[model samples]
Every structure is written in structure tokens, then in C-alpha cells.
Target: MNVAVSNNTTQPAPRVIKHRAWGRFKRNKMAVVGLVIMVALILLALFAPLIATHDPAEQDLLQRLKPPSKEHWFGTDDLGRDLFSRVLYGARVSLSVGIFSVLFNVIIGVIVGSIAGYYGGKTDSILMRFVDMMLAFPQFFLLIAVVTLFKPSLFNIIVVFVVFGWMGKSRLLRGQIMSVKNREYVDAARTIGMSDFRIIFVHILPNAIAPVIVSATLQMGGMILSESTLSFLGLGIQPPFASWGNILQSAQNLTVMTKAPWVPIIPGFMIFLTIMCFNFIGDGLRNAFDSR
Candidate 1:
């Protein structure tokens, strides 16, 4: 009886950490719903070439300002462009802006942060001061100024956002790396004469990346909003290319709003829902990654 009890006690527990994380995420009903909605939106955007009925840029002045009907689902805009088609196509622009801007920021941030944190002296001070200098500037004004100087192209918008967007992330990642660099594994790697480059990239970065991933997720939504704001202000994506922001810009006239409220309403709702979904997913990811 004693031997059997000892054997039972010594039995290894079933491995369930991944399962637990997944279970926790699944249990968060809001997160699950957000995930589903986001996935659906992505699919809708991806297959838009097949699904969208009208050419996004085609204008039919004769059909201009028509209300939603069997022919044009979300109604026609001032130029008689299909609002539904524009909105569907706009998703691609908005999502691309968000994704590319975030990617650019993350790359720059991770590299700067890893170097600053791992080296930790004059390098850290100089890098952090630069980050501070960036923060001191009014982000929106700076972005507008930059975009105005360079022609307002989609690529230019992405670049401008990336330039301003990296500072906060760099600071966050610096703090995370500072905490992680002091771990025993890192010290052991150093002791074993691992090249600093290898140690930082192979060891430190993987551990530090989790928080950065969460931040990136949240930042994506902000990037989308920023892009929309810029586009609404007539400085992003340009005409012939529709985005939710550009759609809103077209509907800015009071008369237009009164006559064709759905013009702004549909795009506005999409922006709101997309951002909310990203935020919820980011929160859920943060909780999942929290070691405690």
C-alpha cells in the first residue's frame, strides 16, 4: 500500500500549459467573439475581388447619391461610386496601412531596443534620449508636416507613421530587455563566451518578444486609426483609392450627411469594430502571456 501510494505521488502530471492558455482564451467570450469577427472581416477583405460587385473607382454621376437598393447595397456616393464596393476595397487599404506601419515600427523598435538594453551605457542613454526627443514632438503635427513635405502617397504615410510610432515601443522593449538580460540563462550564455549578437538575438530577444508582441497588437489598432485620421484629413491613400477615412471625408458635408448618412455610418462602424476587436485580442494575449 505504501509503495503504491509512492508510485502514484511520483507520477508526472499531465502537461497542459498550452491547453490552459487556449482554454483561458476560449473562456473569454468577448475575445472569442472578437476573434471570430476579425477573422470574418479578414476573409471578406481577402476575397473582395470575387465578392465585390462594382469597381471601387468607377463613377456614375447619373446614379450619384442613390440610397441603398437592390443594385447598390450601401448606396451611391457623391460621385456615384458604389459605397459598398468602396468600403469593401477600403478594408484592404486600411488593413495594409495598419499592418505595414506596425511591422515597420516593430522592426525598428526591436533592433534599437535590443542594442540599447544589451549594451547598456552610452548606447542606452543616446538611444533613449533620441526616443525622448521623438516623444517631445507632437505626433500628429509632426506626421502631418512630414506627409505634407513628401507627397501623400500610401508608402509615404506608412513611412511617416513608422518614424513616429517606434519610440513608445522602443521604450517598452528596452524596459523588458533590461529585466530579461539579468536572468541566469543570459549570464550563463555570456559566461560561455556566446557572441553578443548571438546571445541577444537567439536568447534575449525570444524572451523579450512576448511583451513587445502584445504592444504591437495594440499599436496596430492605433496605426489604423491614425491612418484613417490622416486620410480623412485628405493626406492619406489619395483619391481613386478608397479607405474608410476617405469615405468619411467625402461625407463630412452636413448636407451629405443628412441625405446619405449610410455613407459615413458603414465605414465608421467598420473602423470602430475593427479597432475594438484588435484591442480585445491584445488584452487577451497579454493575459495569456502573463507568467503569474
Candidate 2:
């Protein structure tokens, strides 16, 4: 009964289980395309003054409702505002609101969530209850009310968004911190007499930031859309400052939508494309970061 024991005794140490998230992200073609498009859009927005042929706010009723032609690529709006220029400038407003609002949300969320999860006592209960109370309200309606109370401007829009946006990130970060706080390294850090702040910020946050980055990307898209919605409702980035939403707002009249369809069409398409790109890239990031 010579049961031959196989000679492959070394089990290769499980290959160290490295997670190359960036490598995986690079491999996703849609993600790469989305990133490229986003970069191009940002560049266009930044260079709008140099690149745009005419002033976005300049209106010539004589040229109103002109169809797409060699001279005007996207054609002219009802007021004969240069569609291309408005779209380009709109990018600045939209991207600014999205980026800055997300920054505010992330900062507040990380601080609150870190404290709550690290302490895990009355602080957690109090903070979570506050979060829950906020969540109970209808977000968009609340934003609309708040923005209506303040003067309609880019700054006000960003402030309203940040006020509402932090809750979601806070909940997410709290969950992540809870999971990480029980890990061996966290315990070891505490055992070594590391301060609570040091343990949370140094040991835990680095590991927890993967999800935060992914969430932030998706949140950016949402914030952009939210700003656009507010503008469409005539409560964000008022006239003299072109935004996709304000452009679309002009199309509310059915007659204008039919005669000067390009007014809304151009900006609407840009918004759609921008959001889709962000969503694709966000999905890729999420997949790349997932450990399972």
C-alpha cells in the first residue's frame, strides 16, 4: 500500500494577498475613458475665457434660435446667447460646486465619524441621533427651502449642499471605523500607549480611506446634479453666470423648447454625459477597491 505522498510540500505562503487597486482601475477601459473626458471638460472650463469665441452672457436677439451651423457649432439660444460658450462656462460652476461641496462633506464627516466610532459611548449615540434626525427630512426639498431663504448664488448653493451631504459620508465612515477599530493593529497601537487620536487617524484612517475615496467620487456626481437641479428651479447661480441648469430653465416653455431646442439640448446633453462619466468611473473604483 504505497500511498505516494505528493512531494509538493511548500504551499507558496498565499502570495501575500496584495491588492493593486490602481492597477485594477487602469485596466478598466470605461474608467479610463471617463477620467479622460472629465479631465478634458475641466481643462475646457478652466480655459473658457481663452477658448470660447463669444461671451456666454452676450445676447443678440437678432441671432436668436439659430440652428447649428459652421459659425455657431451648438447654435444660439432664444436670447441668442452663444450655446457653446455657455456650456463651457457652465462647466466651471458645476465642477466647482461638486468639488468644494464634497470637500466640506468629507472634512465634517471624517471628524464626526472618527470621534463617534473611536469613543463608542454617549458621543456615538448623540451624534448618530443627530444624523438620523437630519436623514429623516427630504433632502432636495430641504435644500430648496434653505436656498430660497438665502440669496441665490454659487456660494449659497455650495453651502446648502455641504450642509446636507455630510450625513451620508458620516454614516459610511462610522461603519468603516467600527469594523477597523477591532483589528489587531488598532489594539496593538492602543497597547503601545498611542493616543486615541493617533490610533484613529494614523492606524485606522489610512485603511478606511479606500471606501471614502470611492464614495466621494460618486457623491461629486450627485452634488453636480443637485446644483443643476437647484439652478433649473431658478435658485442657483443666477443669470450673468451661465450654468447648465439655468440654460435648461429657459426651455420650460413648450414653444421655446420646440423653436430653440438647442438651448436646453446642448447643456442637457453635457450634464448627462458628465454624470454618466462620473458614474462609470465611480463604479470602476468601487470594483477595484473591493477586497472580496
Candidate 3:
């Protein structure tokens, strides 16, 4: 130390940030529970083929409307397909739609918001006005209208969701960027002759992304619920594809509602459980990112 030795023990900034965030997240009990449930659900979905006892789509007239049993854990659906298998397979579809839709939504939102925020005046005004117009529209009705224009499928559902969902995220990021773009580091990047795109994407986004991450996590739950709604309405994932929504659609029948109530209850509870988990996780992340 007397010979002017350099200290190399300090953690890097990114590592420090990740560690702090994880540490804070771990302290939140509800968040940890949500994380555990979500991880289990994802694993089940991923290994559906190996874990599922019967074919999701296999139809047997005689076995229809049976309650939970040793052979069929969740019981048979109206069509006699195993509810357990269908739920597992449906997880794949529902989770994929939610994840992909949010991913694309966030990507588009970040780009749009960064441009609008980094370059103020005319650029910001025009982009923000467009966002406002989008916000004025009734989002649910818009989603229904657009989804109806295309055939109902997984890819199509995600596409329609992304198209409608990005506006809110863009608005959130725009505000964050506007607040942070004038920071010393951003100014430092600009003074060094960095390209506008690089400065915005590399320097500005990393700092401004906390809110977006929280928003995206919360939005995923809504995305899954919306997909389920569309499927129930017969405008999302079609028959033969086991979605939680489509499974609940059977409850619309008076006979099924009274006779095979578990069919609807299983998927309904799953949807509720997943949404609650996402909400808890979002709350944890929001608290973790709060500097105060």
C-alpha cells in the first residue's frame, strides 16, 4: 500500500447492480413465492410431453366428464381428453404468447420511446402525439377488432397483441428517458463523439430500463389473461389447441357448468395463480429498483 499498489477488489458496476437487485428481491417473501411457482410452471410446461400421462387431444366418448382420479389426475374434459395433459400443453401455448408478445412489445416500445425522448422538440412532439392518440382508443375493443381481421393462431395472437400493447411501454420509457438523457454520463458519451444511436441505446437505455422491466413483468400477466379472454371468445387459440381460455369456454354450457365444474375451475385457478405471481414479482422488482 505504501508502494502505491492499486486496489482491484471492488466489484464491477453491473455486478454490483445485479447483486443488489437480487438481494432486495430475495428479501421480498411474496416475490420469492411467485418466483418459485412461476419456475415450476415453466418447467412443467417445458417437459409436458414427458410428464403428461395422456394425450391432450385424445378423445374418448366413454371417459368424458369424469372427475379427478388416479388415471386422470385432473379428470377428462367434455371431449374425454385428459384435463391434466391439456393443462400442461396449454401452459406452453399461454406462456409462449405472453412471453413473446411482451418481448416484442418492449423492444418496439424502447426504440420508439428512446428516439422521442433523446431528441426533443419536433421529434418528441410528433411521436408523443401519436402515442396519445393510441392511448385514447379503447384498447380492448381495438384488440378484438384487429384480431378478428386475421385468423386465430398463436403467431397471429402475439402479433396483434404486440401491435396494440407497445404504446403504453413507449410512453413509460419516453418519460424515463427524458428524465435521464441529460445526466452526466449521457453528456459524457455525447461529448466523446459517440453516435446518437449508440448514446441513446447504450448509455441512456441501461439507466432508464428499470421502469420498463417492472412494467413488462406486470404486463405479461395481463397478456396471458388477454389471450385467454380471446380464446374464450373464440377469436384466439382455436379448438384442438389446449389454451386455458378455450378450456374455460366449455363452462359456457349449462350442463358442463353444473356437471363438470372442475373443468373450468382448474384453468380458471391456474390463470388467477399465474397473474398473482406475476404481480408479486413486479412489485418486488419495482421496490428493488427504487433508489430511496
Best by lDDT: 3
Model 1: per-residue lDDT, tens digit, 22-94?
7777877777888899888888888888989899999999998899999999999989999999999899888
Lowest summed lDDT window (length 10), candidate 1: 6-15
Model 3 is weakest, by summed lDDT over 10 consecutive residues, at 2-11
Q: Name every residue pair that clashes in candidate 3.
A: none
Best by TM-score: 3
lDDT score of residue 124 within candidate 1: 100
71-186: candidate 2 lDDT, tens digit per residue: 78889887888888889999999999988999999999999988888788999999999999999999999999999999998888888888888988888889899987886666
In order of listing, the candidates' clash counts read 0, 0, 0
Q: Rank by lDDT, highest first.
A: 3, 1, 2
How accurate locally is residue 238 in candidate 2, as Cα lDDT from 0 to 100? 91
In the order shown, the candidates' Cα RMSDs to the true structure are 5.4, 6.4, 3.8
Model 3, residue 273: distance off in Å is 0.7
| lDDT of candidate model 2 versus the reference | 0.85
lDDT of each: 0.86, 0.85, 0.89
Q: TM-score of each candidate?
A: 0.90, 0.91, 0.93
